[model samples]
Target: METRSLRDDEVMKRKLLIIGWDGASFIALDGLIERGCLPTLARLRANGFSAPLNSTLPPVSAPAWTSFITGKNPGKHGIFQFYEVNPWSPKALGRGQRTHMAVPGVVVNSRSIGEAKFWELMSAAGLRLALINLPMTYPPAPINGLMITGMLTPPGARQFTYPPELAEALPPYEIDLNPREKDFSSPDAQFLRRIRDVLAKRTRVALELFRRERWDCFVVIFTETDRLQHRYWHIVDPRCDASEWAHIEADVVDVYRQLDRALAELVRLAGDEYDVLVLSDHGFGPAAIKRLNFSALAERLQLFVSTGGWERNVRRAFNRISSSKRRIYKYLTPLVPERFLHRAEAGLKTLARRGVKAKLIKLHDYIGGVWINTTEHPGGVIEPGPPYEALRTQLMNRLAAVRDPATGKPIIIDVRRREDVYHGPYTTAAPDIIFILDDEYGIETGGRSSELILRIPQKNQGTHRREGILIMSGRAVRPNVQMARANPTAPGIEDVTATMLYLADVPLPEDLDGRVIEEALDEDFLRRRPIRRCSSSRRPSPDVASEVWESAEEEAEIRERLRELGYLE
Candidate 1:
């Protein structure tokens, strides 16, 4: 990879350095910061603006990062999931493609987002930019500087790096935790060292790139914070049931301490002239309960009542035999790699399609997109107009009403119609009904083959929370002010771009969904920066000139990875 030698004139422009610490929740770290366990972070916070930035609607990685880069909602960005279900042909489900077998969707990558990334915009404006291991940046888009994509780039693909030869020149990057090892039980000492090992590799790679590259704006995302939280939150989280570990382990704190050192190194590299902003895609917390199944409840509501008796009976008989009300899902799913389970699950969906299409609601593989398959679907029985609306309402209400038998508290945290959240050309790609998950319980959506509603789809130690962390420090930022956490007025992930653009002296785009977080800056800094907003000259991205390349093999790896990470079952 070629390194840029900054010209004397070019070196003086205000530089922006963004460090993405995915899934670092501020709420979960109150004690750690106050106690000085994370000295570098505490120092930065004492001198900078720290706050909780709201995540995307689903509070997941891809969507949150996409929103941050484009300053647009999923409605405008078209990246609702790591993979988006192609809605072109309803009949396309059983087309026998290896990729769709486990996922049945396109990998949401650089090509998939309908809006241009802020880095791309900055590149077009002639500022050099380097985006390192950023999620959804696969098949690296044309940027002025080097671009190394994250896991979505898939394994064994050379195009994952920009200046394509960079792949040939540099060592490989580890973008995710291996789904094969150190699951929830990983907190044991040896596995804890594995966490350090992975983080070390990332820090080494990032430092090499940061030193060897030249750019006005640079971004690097560290995911160990998020992955460790998923696998070992019990060690650090106060809300977790594993209180025994409070005294037994400090791996969580040690892991964060390593990050603090890594961050301190980056701050030093950035120098006094550059502004550094640290943030996460989503927050993290202990997951006490999983979502309950509501397929049986929907069935009882006559949502599945169709004209055919035999198809319904055959499907019901199969479901009854298989449904231990999810006993199989709870005990068996963890024993196998999630890919085989999805293949089995997809095979069941294929089998169900052979009989009558008796199911009204269908889960796409595990708990991704939920479809109604009402009158809109081919050869469907549910009527379209008044009947469909009523059914959707009933399903939402019933799903919201589901509660833990023991706890008596509602299992759902939020319920929404796809229409309510999304408004764009690719709206159909979204699940018709969206379940905002509760940390307490997991949800299992019934497919055309499934019979019972209540079952355990998957398990994890932690889950995504709505509030991620943001700490911006520079001579221009205010000292020691915390951005309101859980307050409705806090900035969304999308605001990241607008704020950056403002700092870079680029005209703020008025059309974006985000507002500049003026509060995060010093009053004198604001006066010096003098915020300005103009009608956006930007337009939607051009359609892909070529179909984005995808590997069925890589797609399977991603599916297994997502399942292991608890984003999917």
Candidate 2:
């Protein structure tokens, strides 16, 4: 490709603003637009280049957002899910205490990302930036401008913002919704109120920073959209009876309405001077309610071996006792004094935890990934090479053949081996077998249940889909263009970083997996600023200042939040 280098003044002439709605999907947005609920987004779609943004293979937030910022596939960025098998140790680890073959895995964090982010590249090029609420940004790295860390930030942590002193100046800010404040599985007026409050505070802080901070690039992500969708999809989906959730239906729509207003305000603040790009990491849809016990299926297939049957029996017995306790609690709650409630609850929780003891290969609930007992881990049963490959193939075939007894249709839509789906230096860290369940079915990894599949009422009625929303609007972009016509395959989340770099006139890295979205840019802009590529990729040394969690309790707190949000089992 032809390349050019722009002058310092030329690089400073253009500015870009990226607005992220974490899991906004056109599937639901289209209906809202028609109903006149999201006028700001509707106007952007009509005036700008709009298309469905494809996400990563499993399409979960951790990998998808990492891909969006790095211009790399999950294999290259090294975050396949919210959590993966810890490759270095078999000891019990942080976050949900998830284990496989006696090895506990760690939650994905800033240190987990293997590739450099585009903003880091831009910062190196002397561009100012304001990174707000981006996931996996805890222990904020030094940037040219300012940053406020987002999801996975430890609760009550004082070091969430870069330029540490900046934290004191902003309005009261929250990194994410507090999982302790609300039961996300069921709808409550208090939960909706909290969501609105968080949105308002985040918007207030973002606007304050946008107006006060110096920047060439500004990025802010609103995670409330994804949070609301996960809990309230049943209220919004047309197929579901709205009357069933009538109490919170209007409040749910109002949240989106608030988001629409926030979008309008942000864009209005940008005015006509800045090029704007709006997108999502992945889309949202009605969750599959039928839970498939993947570990149970693996056990039945003889691919996974538990420590012993005694553990299973003990777990089942505990479950029965716990169920009976719940029934008794319902009768006693109104009669008993409130002072003793906390002690009783804590005791019950202890009893439940005592039941789950054995560690084995199992499915991950968030991403539908099956961690295999390969020779890579200590005490692994399946040997590497042909045996590993054969086991993966056998499991994939068996999973694909599984059918729903009532519908007589396959429950799993697709299955793939790790190598076939991902490629890069970090591929070895990924799950052995990844599968996609039908939209009507959800998979569970916990081996607490004896049945392979069960019809259950889920508290979280929404889940992520592959196709997200993308809109590019500004003076430099072509007006009213449909990205699908120019690019047969919709642009993936990985493309956003390259597009941002191109707009900022930074030289593209040779190893990037994305291309500049030329079809969406104006011809004059393209002609005036030709593409430039560097000879080698840049891998900066890890910053010593970007520290991990300070204590185990802090790490555990974040994991509990993820579990409450349904990201962890």
**Can you write out model 1's per-residue Cα lDDT over 258-340, one digit (the tens) per residue?**
99889989888888878889988988776644444444434443443322356556566657846673676677777976556
Candidate 1 CA-lDDT value: 0.67
Q: Identify the leading candidate in terms of lDDT.
A: 2
Per-model lDDT? 0.67, 0.75
Clashes of each: 8, 0
The model with the greatest TM-score is 2
The true-versus-predicted C-alpha distance at residue 36 of model 1, in Å, is 1.8
Ten consecutive residues with minimal summed lDDT in candidate 2?
Answer: 354-363
TM-score of each: 0.81, 0.84
**lDDT (10s digit) by residue, model 2, range 1-569:** 22334364374356888999999887778778899999998888888888889889778788889898789998787777666554334323522322323233566678767788888889989999999999988868899999999988878889889999989988898877777654564348778888999999999999999998557999999999888888887777676656878877778999999999988998989988788899999887787768877546644555424334565565566557666865766777899854465465433333333222223332333345666655555445667889877877877787789887677898878888878888877676666677777777777655344467876777677878888989999888889986542245788888878888988888999889988888888998888778888854646533212344577687788778777776655
RMSD of 2: 7.0
TM-score of 1: 0.81
